[model samples]
Target: MATPVLDKVEAESAASPYITVTMRIRRFNPEVSDAVVWEDFQIEIDPKERVLDALHKIKWDVDGTLTFRRSCAHGICGSDAMRINGKNRLACKTLIKDINPEKPITVEAIKGLTVLKDLVVDMEPFFQAYRDVMPFLVTKGNEPTRERLQTAEDRERFDDTTKCILCAACTSSCPVFWNDGQYFGPAAIVNAHRFIFDSRDEAGEQRLEILNDKDGVWRCRTTFNCTDACPRGIEVTKAIQEVKRALITRRF
Candidate 1:
């Protein structure tokens, strides 16, 4: 009986595929040092596992000092947004095999913000930009007794932008954001577009006014980095262009 159980466990272990890879993460702690350090971790992982899973193994099996943020682990929470292979991505959404595993996988905190610790940056600036755009629905008159009706076309108008989960992946990837901290990056513009195009929202012009500033949509250079980095596949650059055209034409 013991031999049979041992054989079964060995068979399962052999059936599972795994590879050894190096995970290089950037470490920054103000309390520790003013300079940044890169920490390397080697772990065995399945090809199907996500980058977030690798982080978990390193934190659990190797180093207890590693720190990061994650929730829901399915890319919806956006808490695990980081720079993977020198690009902004949600750890849960990026598979380890998709990136070149032959080389050390470089995982670092997103740029253009103060790093509170390893892998987590100050999200206050990101959220403040979001709040500035007034992401919620703004309407006039009394509340309707029933749910507000919307045509299929109206819903489709802003549907792409609505997929945003406030992940900050799109914003952190923009080069303009890396240079100018004042620019309300792609994430903010994408959220503004959500309400700006909604047929029922009456505050479109007001939001547009808020965006028509020196640090607004004009700052975007159409680098296409934001579009490439968006985990939700939101046409961020296109949305920014629409906002720019709206500012020019004064049309919602």
Candidate 2:
């Protein structure tokens, strides 16, 4: 009788009891350090563990002071969005197996925002810009007696922007936002596009005027970083381009 061959999973399970991963987390204490610093933590994590899980372990078992925000661990909350290995991603969604296992993963707060603690950043400005766009259905008359009826085609028009989770991932990854904090950023523009292009919205012209400013959608260079970093797979650049097209067409 021949011996049974073990698969990769079985081999890994038999060979190693646990996998050790080094996480180089960015540390900054506003009261203690004049600048940001890097702190490394070696964690014996399971192969199936996620980056967020490792972070939680470090916070719970290793360091009680390590800070990061998380609401839903399934990537829907978007509160745990950060820069991992210089790329924007949701910590809950990234798996240890997908990255360079041998090398240390660098985790930092999202760029273009004020870091409150280890991986937590203040997102007030990001939300303010979102509010500035007035991201809601504004009907001229009283509320409809029933739910606003619309065809599938109408819903599909703004479907791309509807995927946003208000994570600030798109806005933080934007270069224009980095240089100019006043810029509305990708997330805000994405939300504006949602209402502006909606068939049911009656504020297209007014919203377009708001986005016509220098720091509005005009600042977007179509870099596509926002789309790449988006966890929800939204077409951020496409929506920004559509808004630009509307602005130009309406002028003539």
RMSD of each: 4.0, 2.1
The CA lDDT at 210 in model 1 is 90
TM-score of each: 0.93, 0.94
Candidate 1 residues lying further than 4 Å off, grouped into runs, are: 1-16
lDDT for each of the candidates? 0.93, 0.90
Scored against the true structure, residue 103 in model 2 reaches a CA lDDT of 96
How far off is model 2, as Cα RMSD? 2.1
Report the error of model 2 at residue 19, Å.
Answer: 1.2
Tell me model 1's lDDT, rounded to 2 decimals: 0.93
lDDT of each residue in 12-84, candidate 2, tens digit only: 6787667889999999877787688999999998757789999999999999989999999999988999999
